[model samples]
Every structure is written in structure tokens, then in C-alpha cells.
Target: QADVLARATTWRDRLGADTPRVAIATDIEQAATLELLAGVMLAGGSVVAERPAPTTARWQRWAAERVTTVVGDPDVARGAPDAVTVLDLDGSTSPRQV
Candidate 1:
């Protein structure tokens, strides 16, 4: 517990006061997916743990949540507009920018 707290404090200090918002929105909870979400958060961002269904209500909720990035299966954000950024988890070195 002490070590964990120490590391958390160290990271907070390293990231500084103004942590940029990465907004990692995803439904899948695989190791890579979780890693991405955690990475973004640790780097001063957010994680929206939800799946994409392309429904009006879901869209509104996403908008309200200010989700800027979707990371998961391609079908997750299949019909998303070009304005919305999507990252594919296709076993690549990094998230595939789409």
C-alpha cells in the first residue's frame, strides 16, 4: 500500500497539474484495452468504459461525456463520423489511428 501510494504520487507529480484529456472510450476490457485506458489516464486523460451501439441516446451520452477517442473493435465505432477519432486494437505496436 505504501509503495502504491508513493508511485501514484510520483506519477501525479511527473504528469503535473494540467493533465491533458485523452478520453479513451471503449467497451472491450482486454489487457491491451485496459492498458490503453490506464495509459491515457496516467498521462492526464479519461476513460469512458462503454461500447458503441450507434444509438441516438448513446451518441448524446457520449457527447455529454466529451469523449474524443474511441478504442476497441472496428464495429464499435463503425458508423462514427470522420470528426470522431477511432483506434483499432488489431495487435499492432500501437493503436491504429483511423
Candidate 2:
């Protein structure tokens, strides 16, 4: 899990220290979900789990929870507003903007 933590640390840094909550919106089977959640907690941040659902519902939950950083599916991340940062865990080369 060190590798996961390391990656998560990198992501957390990008998210910034003031970020209070990290949202997870990926399938449970995805290893990155657990790793990112653990990493965020270790960094003294809270976590909000977003159920796998429609893009609108997921984004709504994120907005309602005031999610600072999102770590999971890129598709859902696309729906996040410009205020939220998205860390895509699908191993894609291109990064998701807002």
C-alpha cells in the first residue's frame, strides 16, 4: 500500500493543506478507492463516500457534502465544479480539469 499512499500524498499536495474533505466515487473493487481514502485520513482529512450512481446524483452529493478533492472515476469527476479538484485513478495520461 506504500505505493498507493505515495500517489495519494502527491494528490493530496495538489489538493492543498486547507482541503478538509476527500470524496471517493469509485467502485469498491477498485483498489485506489481504499488507498486514497486511507491516505486522506492519514493526512488529517475527512472522507465522503459517493455511491455509484448517475452522474447527476454523484455530483449533487459532492456539492452537498462540499467535497474539496475527489479521488476516483474520471467520468464523475468531470461533473465537479471548478472549485473542486479531481484526481482520476483510471491511469489515464490526461488529467481531468475541475
Candidate 3:
């Protein structure tokens, strides 16, 4: 949707100017994921893919990187760094008419 893209652009400007490093966790094919990835790239931040089946060790590794922001399901990010801010994008309804 144009509106969503516009909003994403604004977010990109607000967050991208500094080129902060960001971590993304979601299916790359999903629309929201694509939008977020684009935003992160536009913001000049490195996008690291979070493993769906992340282990404690993996989370620790991510935490060690000091990722300041994360965009993904809150439930999946529970064990990540407490200082990391998470943006949840699970409220969108499915487009399937059925």
C-alpha cells in the first residue's frame, strides 16, 4: 500500500540518517519484512538475519554485537538484550479473502 510505503519512508528518514546497525527477524518474502529490510538498507544500517530457531548461544552472540534495534515478533525477541528495542509487526491481517 502507498500509505504504508510512505510511512516506511518517513521511518527510514528518521532512523536511517545515522546509519545505525539493525537486526531483522522475519521471513524475507513477507511484505512487512521486505519493507523493513528496505528501510534498514535505506537508513544505511547493516541487516542481520535472526535465526528462527535461535539458541541461547546465538542470542548471546547477537547481544554481544550490541544491536540497538530489532524489528520482529516480540515473542521471538524475548531472550535478546534487554536494552534492545523491539518493533512488533504482527497485527496486520491476512489478505486472503477466504
For all candidates in order, the CA lDDT equals: 0.50, 0.67, 0.61
Candidate 2 C-alpha error for residue 41, in Å: 1.0
Worst 10 residues of 2 by lDDT: 89-98
Task: Candidate 3: give the clashing pairs.
Answer: 16-43
The residue-by-residue lDDT of candidate 2 on 1-98, one tens digit each, is: 67877877765565567856877656768766666666676667888876656655776777888887776665666777876776666523235645
Off by over 4 Å in 2: 1-8, 52-56, 90-98
Rank candidates, TM-score, best first.
2, 3, 1
Worst ten in a row by lDDT for model 1: 89-98
- Among the numbered candidates, top lDDT falls to 2
By descending lDDT, how would the candidates be arranged?
Answer: 2, 3, 1
Which has the higher TM-score value, candidate number 1 or candidate number 3? 3
Model 2 TM-score on a 0 to 1 scale: 0.65
Per-model clash counts, in order, read 0, 0, 1
lDDT of 3: 0.61
Candidate 3 per-residue lDDT over residues 20-40, each given as its tens digit: 566765566787766676667
